[model samples]
Target: MKTNVATTLAELKKNEKDDFYSSISFANEEIPLEQESVKRKLDKYLRKFSYLERSSHQIHRKADQLLPRIAKILKSYGIPDDFKYIAVVESSLNPGTTSHKGAGGYWQFMPATARLYGLRVNGKVDDRLDLTKSTHAAARYLKSLYSEFGDWTLVAAAYNVGGGSLRGSLKRQRKDNYYDLKLNAETAAYVYKIISMKTVLEKG
Candidate 1:
């Protein structure tokens, strides 16, 4: 079993290095891999998630325990099940991971964002750390974003950089497409990370 897992991960890395990826997608939107830059960018994240982060074994173990609950909550809100990958990309399925900016929980919601989405984040309690509560909050937040952006790819981008910042970038750049926008480095690659996680986690 250990050897099989290692082989699978190694195969993923090898495939990423080649043109084995004939297509890529996010939120039902087909990524235009005909564009060499887009293909390379996504391939980089694929390698990062499949090989460079916590071991595939560790991430898969945590994901096995977490994604089902996250998926159920997202579906309850009428959101795409694919959005569960947001949690994977954000926190690597680690319920206790905290960001330097004080964002905590599986969904990585900052204090203000957590409170805005009906989560309590006071001194005595931080609902952002609760799996069920935070996943629900994240679903509501994603629904709100989808209403505004009307695109799951854009919603994913907004989730990382905030709706306001994404709107400003879209306006300044005169581009509604997430892939074409000149966002900050992090936001630009954010969707790709989610998609990468989706691909690896789902395929495995």
Candidate 2:
């Protein structure tokens, strides 16, 4: 079993390297690749790294396992598929993790935010650490922010910073785009980090 696993990993590595080289072609001092071809390569690499073969039921397990169920919940709530990454970013889809700042659960809500969103927060019980309840709260909050901002990126930004703060920054900078606006270090890199994690999880 060990030898087989090692061989499988080696094959996957070789395949990924092949995919990388095959997709890139240099021209006019720039690199370009056909969209369809690149996507095929990526899809192949992602399939090789699929979570279905893994047995370690930790963060990856939680994220991979819960996504389908969470998708259903989000669909029922009329939320977009993109919001799925928010739960992954929050607690790595783990229900047991807690931040030092007191954020908890798959959605990682602070005490105040959890309370405001109607998730119970107390010594005897902390529903902020519960995946289902927290995700529901997060979905609702994100939907409300989307209604206010009319942009998914802005809603993501507001999730990092407060909605009022993000709106103020947009007004001051005269740019509503999250990628273009100057934000605090944490908020600035937050979305990109989430995106990177998404790529890794979806492709690993």
Candidate 3:
């Protein structure tokens, strides 16, 4: 009887191990996981997910709420639909959000950068908090960055770290590609964050 009980316990353990491995394989299969770069980005996404998950849901809700207006504006400006996800990663679609660095509004534009992008950022009326105006300003700034870098990923990185800084990094690193250039942690993760948000929003 003891021998039979031991054999049964061994079978149960083997079955449990097989089940766990199968679950992991199923999850990876569902997500179609591939590429080292994507895996790295997904890892970063998971680290930030605890803090950003609720905000991500809020962003999706806000996207649905404002879709018509935002879509019309984006269409008028000739910006791609996917660019809306940038705003999600920037401010979670909350117009009143202000970063520690003084970037404010749905697109999280710093005062100086906002002013340069044709946004009025005075004491009384900060246009950065105005969703319509801020989206337009963001579109214009993104268009200019796209013009300079000619690559959306590089443009997104430059948007986070500024065009001059990105240019300097490219020159110093002797690498024109954004992925090849080493950058500060925030700037390096910026594009990946945007990509992750885009993926989530699309899947939703």
Clashes by residue pair, model 2: none
Q: List the residue pairs that clash in candidate 3.
A: none
Off by over 4 Å in 2: 1-57
> Best TM-score goes to which candidate?
1
Per-residue lDDT of candidate 3, residues 1-204 (tens digit)? 999999999999979855633332210113223445745665577457534665557666777886567667776877666667678778878888898888999889999989988999998989998889988888899889878877666777888899999989988899876666789999987766766665555544
Best by lDDT: 1
Give the CA lDDT, 0 to 100, for residue 189 in model 3: 79
lDDT for 147 in candidate 1 is: 93
| Ranked candidates, highest TM-score first | 1, 3, 2
Off by over 4 Å in 1: 1-23, 53-56
36-95 per-residue lDDT for model 1 (tens digits)? 889889879888877744464888887888889888889999998888988888887776
TM accuracy, model 3: 0.75
What's the true lDDT of residue 125 in model 3? 88
* Model 3 bad stretches (over 4 Å): 1-38, 46-56
lDDT of 1 at 115: 95
Candidate 2: residue 174 lDDT (0-100):
98
Lowest summed-lDDT stretch of 10 residues in model 1?
17-26
All models: lDDT? 0.85, 0.71, 0.74
TM-scores for candidates 1 onward, in order: 0.87, 0.70, 0.75
